[model samples]
Target: MSFSKSFLVGIGTGLLFGSGVTILCIRLQRVAREMDSLSNAIAELATQMSVLAEHLSTLRGFKQRKKRNEFYSASSGDEDEIFEDANLSFISSDSDISKGSKNRSTEDKILDTHVLFNKVEKLFEGDEKNQEEAFRLLSRSAPQHSADCGFHWRMSKACYLVSKIEKSRDNPAKAKDFLQQSVDHASSSLKLDEKCSSAHRWYAISLGSYGEHLGSQEKIKNGFLIKDHIQRSIDLKPNDPFNHHMMGRWAYSVYMLSWMERKLAATLIAAPPEAKIEDALESFLIADRLRPTIWKENLLYIAKCNIELKRLDEVAKWLEAADAVPVQTKDEEEAQKEIDQLLPKYQTS
Candidate 1:
């Protein structure tokens, strides 16, 4: 071959080999980028899977054998659950209220106060018959006229005393009527001075009793107004834990009714889309925080919320906590037991 032809062939062969090497390098770079993108996507998927797994752990202990219909049927007659507290202690004792009078001789004031205190003590400690006897004595002996003392103050004292007696009687009907009377007298006292928190408290209690009455009659439509009365009570006495507890109860009742209704209807029409489950969860959470140990209703709502949100794991956690806490009374215990029995069934269904 000639020298020029040999040089041209050599140069062409070198260029072809160099071009192939460059193309191979470009292919390798593109493959590395694709691999990096896939790795990032896999990491994100793993994080989401971890979150989902944690959520599922909460529901892991829940049994899946029970049916939803069985749970609902068992919970249908939840009437006794409504009256969880019939034995809560009233706020004040007679001794707390009856300090000795200045005008009456010290000896006389002491004597009167002791006797009244003893009567009240007996009223609270006694059964139905003894309570009635104490009530009669209080009606007869309570100073008919604290004339030199303020009339409004005396009226409040009288009303408060009667309320204690009636509450101690333990007869719902009589207790309610007496509470209404107390409310009227308290209102009269407040009309004389509108800023009296005591009067407002008394009125709120009366309103609560009225709400209970409506509930007892199955007037759920009317009973919806209980929230207003309870809210007013909270506003009037923000310092009192009792009123706050009542407010919690009020909110719980609303949340429960919403839940029950939602379950029956298959969806929430009253609550917004995001709010359907979230609203119930929010209310129950507030109630749970405000009064943790005593709020079985709060826990119940939380369980149901977790169920609706499909966070079975959370439901199990809350149910465990609920199961550990004593239910406070026989009725509460029974109700909780029923709920416990229903949990697995409902979850499976």
Candidate 2:
């Protein structure tokens, strides 16, 4: 009676022990594979950081170019030399930018810059914080996604913020340099993805700033390109209010060209760029409708366009709307300051 029972018990114990060992071996193999994968990733990241350091070291050597003559033709953009100077191009080609035909978001993050885009958006969202910190984050994250168009545009935005943000404005030379970097990063964004609306939008805006800060010739010459790229941005993403506001700015500048400026353009350019106050007003109004109470700049420009049209009542109406917009950032404070300056003149007129 005891022999059969003992034999059966031993067989069962042997089978259980073998099963436990098999499961443990499988788990150990899995953990080993994961560790190897993690180690490889860390090594690759270290290599990228090293390469990025070299590129950025070269970037630190950037010197400001001398001002061009006023007679410089406003025909072509003539910006190759500036880009050639910065030499900040990145070759990171393995970043995951595989969104299909249209943009699809991963939960809250849009534009694949390793979720840094969301962080960057928040950096500009609330009361202004350390500008240098934002620039550092973008620079640190850039090399890993150098081939990613998203990183380039975001880097351009960070450069813009450092250039024009309140305290940063104290250093005009640094601001100007950062502004050029903004243009360079933004242009790189376009080279990587021409169809990207944000890239085109930022590129146009940065180019416009470079022209405005650098010289009148640059502004007047880049005007057509700004108009074209901003138009493309609008065409690509019709719902973006920022694009509409930019388009309005282009139109307003054209309509406000002085008689001398107009004569010069007519003489030099066979078909000088043309725009009307009504067109600007229309674009501004559309932006107003698209995002109410967000952009006081859009409201101020709307008032300016109306002032041009001799619509004093409408001017007052828009100024009131501009005044109502809550000011958070220094940029918003500056926009409000402009409104304050314009209010007395328009109220009396």
Per-candidate TM-scores read: 0.40, 0.66
Q: Write the per-residue lDDT of candidate 1 for residues 20-120, one digit (tens) a residue.
A: 76566556545555665556456545654554454343223121212222122111110010111111112132242233122224434433433453344
Q: Please name the candidate that would achieve the greatest TM-score relative to the true structure.
A: 2
- Per-model C-alpha lDDT, please? 0.47, 0.68
Clashing residue pairs for model 1: 58-313, 59-312, 59-313, 66-345
Give per-candidate clash totals: 4, 0
- Minimum summed lDDT over a 10-residue window in model 2 is located at 71-80
Provide the lDDT at 106 for model 1.
48
